[model samples]
Target: MPDTPTPLIWLAGATGLVGRALLTELGHEQPVLALLRRPDPSLPAQQQQQQQTALVDYAQPASFAALPAPSQVFIALGSTIAQAGSQAAFRAVDFDAVLTVARAARQAGARRCAVVSALGADPRSSVFYNRVKGEAEAALVALGFERLVIARPSLLDGERASLGQPARRGEQWALRLMRPIAGLIPAAWRPIRPERVARAMRLALAQEWAAVQVLESAELQTVGD
Candidate 1:
């Protein structure tokens, strides 16, 4: 049992866009244990002096085993298909890497796991992105987390410098077009801010839900809005 009542959060993808937002939100609130592929020497000394930082290599189980015991874990690992450059590479990052961390967290006594997946995630989908997201979700569930919350948000709105990425241009245009008729779009398809998704994850972490909580894109929008 932890000395304090607040649950320790195990965060993966600590360097990504969503992960950075989560790090900002959770700043000095609760204990956080982050897993990074290549541990940042300065980051460990700066933020997590009393906290834990484990360097993880997804290809090896020994690296996964280094994670500390945590009650809650959050995963925001993802890659663009272009960045992945191949279907197998995409699966390795989006699916295998996620499961690797999840299984390790479960083995280390993590009770809850939260994931940030896309809007149309379905294993049966012909789309590669959706299929990978859906498969990752399924694999996480199989890890037997007592409380699992999957957050599916559309066009995550975050303040980040776009590095010549064209993926979200249409979503941004659609949101701008729909802004005048905001009442029309369905909940699951609404654009959401990344901070709101982080808030929802924090809320889900603090509370216990009997059923697996799946926050559709619309629900995320509501929370984010």
Candidate 2:
């Protein structure tokens, strides 16, 4: 690998809220290769011309060949089991897709892999969501990357496209009530901006750390703050 000041990065889920925020934070700092599930002509217009976009069908492992070799890989991949409508579909995106990318990055000689996970991710949890996240974290840990960072955030403070939904409304209300008393809340349970998470992810790759660092919400907020 070239001993360049800024390393090349491969970013998955570049269209998601956090992913897009990461791209913004990464702008002009390093060369970025953004991967999307399908070719979107509009994406080029939305992103800086210097950034490279690759169309990949993550469901098909063979499509990974379309991606360029990168020094680091950032995964912001996620899915709600509710939206997936099935447990299997949820795991497919949250776990399977990430593993595929991790394997590809390892093969491409990436120095590090950083991913955004959620809070309460325990593979042993009876709750399906946390179980999947925990399983994914375990899988990534086993990959033995030279540097691996997993960010687990709580009650992400971000806007949903659909604001009228009951869940969004409830979340907004809870955040409003908590924002005033955020200092009183435990570090692990405070709400954090998605942008903060994105910034932390970028820093994880840019900075040096001990092997297999798991960034709890407290650590993530500290970096983001």
lDDT of 1 by residue, 46-152 (tens): 56664566778887868866455778788988887776889899899899899988888888888888888888999989998999899888888877778999988
Error in Å for residue 49 of model 1: 4.6
Cα-based lDDT at residue 149, candidate 2? 90
The regions of model 1 sitting more than 4 angstroms off are: 1-7, 40-52, 162-186
Q: Which candidate has the highest TM-score of all?
A: 2
lDDT of 1 at 180: 69
Prediction 2 global C-alpha lDDT: 0.83
Clash numbers, per candidate: 2, 0
Residue 90's lDDT within candidate 1 is 87
Which residue pairs does candidate 1 place in steric collision? 187-218, 188-218
- Compose the digit string of candidate 2's lDDT tens values, residues 26-52: 765778988888764544365667688
